[model samples]
Target: MFKVKVYVTLRESVLDPQGNAVKGSLNSLSYTEVQDVRIGKYMELILEKSDREVEETVKEMCEKLLVNTVIEDYRYEIEEVVAQ
Candidate 1:
């Protein structure tokens, strides 16, 4: 078995309104030390062993559905699971 962890975030050139809102709220709460805030998405998926390469499958999934390539960037980690 394999476990995949995917992280998606706004592209560096993209404006993150949600993150900015959070930062504003934090500052209003007197958390002035925060210089910026960037919001992101994390997901986990499990798959049985397959003939396909895990990384390639994950990349295709991300590019096709999980991420908006024009505005977002993504990365993934794969871990092998040993069934007990």
Candidate 2:
């Protein structure tokens, strides 16, 4: 078995209103050290296969269908799960 962790975030060039809102709240709370706070999505997937080719294919699927390259950036890591 394999476990995958996916992270999707907006590109740096794009403005994130949600993130800005969080930053504003933080600042209002006297958290002045917080700057450029950005929010992203996290996903976990489990696959039955543990092959290098399959991992690459899943990554490509994320880039092509799961993520919008123009505005969002995505990265995924796959790890083999050992049974006890």
Candidate 3:
């Protein structure tokens, strides 16, 4: 089996309102040391061994549904796992 770890984040050129909100809250709570905050999405997908290339499949999934290509960027790690 393979385990895929996907991380999605807003593009640097895009504004992250949610992250800004969190940062603002933190600052108000006297956490002034923080310079910036960026929120992202983490996802795990378990995929059975298949004929398709893992990297290609993951990239297709990300570009098609897992992430917004225009505004978000994503990367993934694939690990082999023993099924219990």
lDDT of 1 by residue, 9-84 (tens): 9999999999999999999999999999999999999978673688888898999999999999999889998766
What is the alpha-carbon RMSD of candidate 3 to the true structure? 1.3
In order, candidate lDDTs are 0.92, 0.86, 0.92
Model 1, C-alpha of 9: deviation from truth (Å): 0.2
Off by over 4 Å in 1: none
Candidate 2 — what's its lDDT?
Answer: 0.86
Q: Residue by residue across 1-84, what tens digits does model 2's lDDT show?
A: 788888999999999999999999999999999987999999888777658576787777787888888999988888888755
lDDT for 84 (candidate 3): 100
Residue 77 error for model 2, in Å? 1.3
Error in Å for residue 42 of model 2: 0.4
Model 3: what TM-score?
0.94
lDDT of 3 at 70: 96
Off by over 4 Å in 2: none
- In terms of lDDT, the poorest run of 10 residues in model 2 is 48-57
Instruction: Give every collision pair in model 3.
Output: none
- Write one digit per residue (lDDT tens) for candidate 3, span 8-83: 9999999999999999999999999988999999999998866367888889999999999999999899998888
